[model samples]
Target: MSAPLLEVRDLHKSYQLKGRPALEILHGIDLQLPAGECRPICGRSGAGKSTLLHILGGLENPDRGEILWKGESTRGWDRSRWAIWRRKAVGFVFQSYHLIPELTVEENIRLPAMLAGVPLEESWEDLLDEVGMTLRRDHLPAELSGGEQQRVAVARALVLEPELILADEPTGNLDGASASAVLDLLVKMVRQRQKSLLLVTHDETVAGRVGTPLRIADGRLAGNRS
Candidate 1:
């Protein structure tokens, strides 16, 4: 493939397990995510899937590696630089749906734009329609269901027209039906928007739906290179 939209190299992380030796979380993880590809990086519970996602999203730092976004190295980036990178190039979705309780659907969707100093436009409203949440645009997070909240979250992530989206268990909080719907909507948005997606999930079924799975086992990519 062409130069990846995001490249993770030699990533390593560890945490102190209470009363035990430092527990390693990630071991030399290297993954390349190209533009317009929606791929799942999966592992069982406690397999460091979220860690990898967090590092890739710039929410956390890796101990020993570099992340290249659009061929620019992030290793030397200060917090401010990382923040700017996140606002412009990276979007994130969490399992908890992270919607602001005080904001309406449209307000929540526009949050990223506000952070990036870009005003929301009519096209963003069209994004709400595309995500099947146009009717809930005026509703608050508390007024919406889990699936509805997730839809808004997805729209929020897309508002900045980010090149890459890092979603950590996007469907973990929803039911089977809701999960299916959310996954379908997310995949559609990724394809239609031509944005790359790195989805972190524990469910093989969920992982299978997006793309080929890169399994993480014992803090390493299990049997897969990238």
Candidate 2:
């Protein structure tokens, strides 16, 4: 078997709160994700699921531990290096649909590729079509529906074709129909691209759709079930 596409070892993170002992959010998280696997992290509110996702995506630093991308240690990398890694190797989807209101759907989808210096013409049309937003490609975030905005975010996340996609509560704000539609699109895209996915969600039914669900509690990975 080949090495995992992403690996986390002994991961730890904490923050100091005013007049209190440091609050440790994650404690020695160890996980390995092979290429093309869609894994869900399920937990109750305040279980540190988002923090772990941020750490894994290089958005936040771990006080202790290591993250290896394709077997390369990410420790001690500066902000610029981390930024490049994020642009080149990771994509993030958030429940809030973090699309810039000023940018059109096509522009939003092209931003990451542009940051990575990928030519605009290379992925614009294909990505828009893939997310079924080609017809709405010229629309701004505010003009789109919740599901449409999220779909644009999904397209943007895939524009760079990163090895791993990290999503935090991706369907949190949508109605049941919209949620199911968006989730289905996300799963289909991930599978078709053969990219690894680690999603943080509260819905057990949604979690069951992934390859496996890993539960987190008390700052630790509790259990993994198929």
Candidate 3:
């Protein structure tokens, strides 16, 4: 059988506090994400949801575990190798919109491609339209509403056409209407592009709106709900 798109086995992470023992975050997290699948890790604040997501996305390292990409272990990869993989295969959508204040909306969307040394293809324009931000492409992030900035963020995430998307607290700072709109746009775009999504959210409503819901508490996956 073909391997899963992504998998983790016995994942563990801990943070060292000053003059104290390490505080464990993830306790042997095991997960498998199939190609084109969407999964949500639901947890309260400080429940280790974000840690797991960051580790899975290669932004952080786990103290003990195997992060497998298509059955190949990433344990031996160097920083440059991980960076290359992230650039070519992964995209991230952060809660804060993380747009460069100096860059225009279109510039922010195209930044990834430029960094990856890939050409700005015609699909770039389509992505703007998909996120309903084509008309605002020239505006700075501060000029847009919360929802509009998030729309641009979504466009930025998809601009690279990566196979995997990691979304962290995607709607933590938005109001009800704006949050709903951003979540809807994220799901629709991921589905339409046939990309895999691993979303970390504390809100149960947001979790339910995504695909399968996996609850995490006290550094472990508590349960899975359909």
Clashes of each: 0, 0, 0
TM-score for candidate 1, residues paired by index = 0.95
TM-score of 2: 0.95
Kindly list the per-residue Cα lDDT of model 1 for residues 1-226, writing each as its tens digit: 3688888888999987789999899989888888888889888899999988888877888889888987888878999998898899878889999999999998999999887788777899888998888887889999988999999999999888989888999999999999999999999988898999999999999999998889999787754434
Please provide, for model 3 over 1-226, each residue's C-alpha lDDT reduced to its tens digit, 9 standing for 90 to 100: 8998999999999999999999999888888888899899899999998789889888898999899999999999999999999998998998998999999999999999988888988979999998888888899988999889988889998888899999999999899999999999999999989999999999999988997799888787856634
Candidate 2 local lDDT, 15-107, one digit each (tens): 999999999889888888888899999998888989999888788889999998888888868899999888888889999999999999888
Off-target runs (Cα >4 Å) in candidate 1 are 17-19, 223-226
List runs of model 3 lying over 4 Å from the truth. Answer: none
Please tell me which predicted candidate would have the highest TM-score against the true structure.
3
As for candidate 1, its clashing pairs are none
Whole-model Cα lDDT per candidate? 0.88, 0.88, 0.90
Worst 10 residues of 1 by lDDT: 217-226
User: By summed lDDT, which 10 consecutive residues of candidate 2 come out lowest?
Assistant: 217-226
By lDDT, the better pick of 1 and 3 is 3
lDDT, candidate 1, residue 70? Answer: 76
